[model samples]
Target: MARSYSSYIVAQSKRTPCLQNVCQFISDDCRKHDCKIVSLEFFAQDEKPRRTDLDQLNLEALLNTDVCGCQGRLIIVEDLSTAVIETLGSCLDIDPLFFASQIHGPTFDIVSSKPSDAILPSRALSQNFLSVQYQRTVDFGACSSAPRKMLRNSNVPRKIVLLPPIKNRSIGLEQQSCSILLSTTKSKPWLGLILVDKPNSDKYTTSEKQLVLPSTPFQGGYEDFSERPCFFEPDSGSPGRVSLLEDLVYYWEKERPPAFQPDQPTLLSLTYYPLKIAAAEWVSYVAVISHSIKQFEYSTEATFEEHGLRKIDSDLRSLEVWGRRCLQTSSKLQSAISFLKYQINGAPELEEYSLMIRDFEYIADLVTTYGRRLEIMVPVVTSVLQITDTRRSLKEAANVTRLTYLALLFVPLSFVASLFSMNGGVSAHDLTIYFAVALPLCAMVFFVTRLPTFDFVPLGPAFGKFGNWMRKAL
Candidate 1:
């Protein structure tokens, strides 16, 4: 038997010309973009996934077939092409603007309902668009071919520095962007499209690679490359690690499924993972910063002991960079969480997904706490740095005071010697006369400089009383 579109879509095709027209549009758009569907799966209430290769699937016959009872569908694509966006909009009866927002704008999470003037009413009245970032270990193989110069020693051991977010710098860490589109339709089960844009090594041009600290995120590789795991294999009996997005679509496909899909609301509950993961990253980042601050103190003390109070302007600069990075990342995370909370609460379709509501609320609270923690660290870091600067200044001042003491003792002796060397002075060979004049002059100058009134006294009480008498004589 030949494979076909999901039963619900086929059934709806017979009743509504709008869905058929949308399917036709998807086909036309797909050809225009030269796009290929990575994978497509259809699910019914109590049946196995009717998975098929969408690239070879015919879109025309899909509208003529008659089938029923599709509870959900999943489409996985490597790129967010125009065709994918339009198809999602048509299927869920949503505005394409919601799905396209992340493309041109910044990454964020938003939930939107069908506009009042939408042509078709959807059973799933709301749609969710999520854009989240996740950290991944650098792929050295992919990065090696990039236009950027690789470190001389490929395996050179270097300490991972998070202050500058080495992960984002194409160093030891990489951040991948995951854009998810989730919705359900009157004719289809829960539908989800995931577009994971891996960091392209070629995205960074030669000029960008030369920067000591690039202003923008570093592109991992600069060469032509193909993204991997474009399609997530459905979990079989073997245990495997599935990401939250993958877990959402293939939940029922798991051998020991954690929970059955009660309805589309249940699917909404899974949306919590993105925000939760983001918050968790924030907590981890703050923890790293706190530890780094402690390390900064210890290292500074050791540096002072070994190098004798050398200036650490570089360390201060690094702290400033870390602070700015923290604020920028934290603000973004907060905005994303706040927006998600507001949209989810106001969305009528999500009323049944109570777990999702609570999850986001908890995330909001935790983010608030972590943000405060980050803020508190600022003063503590500043204080530590301030103490270092003060110590350096004091050390410099102490050296100056010792030099002043030497100058006090030497200046008068030097003056007497100069007089003896002149033609008008007694013979230079007259050692007795030279000692007689130089010793007294040097002693007088030293005593006057050490007098308490002049505030040069650094001796005991014996010197103190003598110095006070000298001050009166002066």
Candidate 2:
């Protein structure tokens, strides 16, 4: 008997009512069909999702994921709301499935949200710094009979910086979207490298209109290469597709060395910006973290230690996720470069590749440095926290000692006063009453110490008014 099909209900996830258009039966419904797969992308220009659905839509799909190996779910948001962060935390709280569960708990990782407070470099990336060889043929050959100085800048440090956004930045190269080439024989798509961005009026220059050509399939017109560029639409639905867009990139993969195993199907929107802009964002992310690390490393006061450590840990995780993503992204861009070389003869694609590689190198080093720094600092920070706890324990012990002495002073009086109430040799009965009074009194004293409220601070009235206003406002 043929299996019956469920109505196309655009089923909502049990996690949230606001979550809609979930592809519930795609895999089963198309099992026997000609293997048609449709993947969708919500670009950076699209409107943000409603606040309520934020948790269930992206997060719910991301948790039960199998993407590139040794990574966690990454959600890049324009606005970092408490709800979103909380949702992300819950999604990562625990991987319940036997296959998905790797790290005991909390797998979802968010790399960045909002504009970074990075100590941004003054110059645009294009003008940041080019390698310049300063050389002079000196007659010092006469002074030493041979060149005394064979100084080569082998270990010269390049400034890793987040550049300020450029205005009227010449329309970055016009590129084509990815496409698949069809064959009459066996069925399998030839994955193509796609264009990541297009020239926009605000960012790209007017010259782009003429320089940029519409994407077209190869027709043996290889001589006039400027008219076409190779671009492939990334298929998010299949894990076997080596080149992946941000939306399809997996958070957690169990495989080692991350081989191409496109067996899983994923559906969700990801934060996708132009490649250049994404690189810029990642750089700023690193710079801001580096700055924050510097602040903690140099500060003389202990005041920043507590909150600072939390921030440090959070940023560290972000770096680790960002690093893996960059590594994967860089590998994929190589194909793009090769395609550019073929499509646009004598294009400066190699230079662009170098720039990306340089940034990638910096990103890798930053992650390594941060990881080592954190490994060292974690122990030291833990010791400091332990010391704090010891100090607090000692203070509490001292207070307890004082209370014990005061209780001793009343012991004889309380006993003698209770003697009168006891019918001769009914002292045990009176003792039970004594415990009732003493137990309550001790409990009150112990718990009162924990309360932040003090007699001198009249904060109740003001706090009450604030609470009332907040309730009305909400």
Candidate with best TM-score: 1
How much lDDT does each candidate structure score? 0.44, 0.30
Candidate 1 per-residue lDDT, tens place, 169-241, comes to 3333334345556654444445655554422232222334522233222232221111233257642432112
* Model 2: lDDT to the true structure: 0.30
lDDT score at residue 409, model 2, on the 0-100 scale: 51
lDDT string for model 2 (1-474, tens) is 532111112221233221111122222232211111222222223222111122324544543444433122223222122233234334332111111111011112243111111112232111211111111111111121111112111111111111111221111111112211111112122111111211111111121231221222111111210113336744323122112233222222211112212222111011111233334334444443454344334233333345755644544454454345334334334433333333334546345434444554665566556656645555555555455556667778999999976775565456555654566654677778767766665554444433443232465666545545543442
| Model 2 CA lDDT for position 449 | 38
lDDT, residue 118, model 1: 28
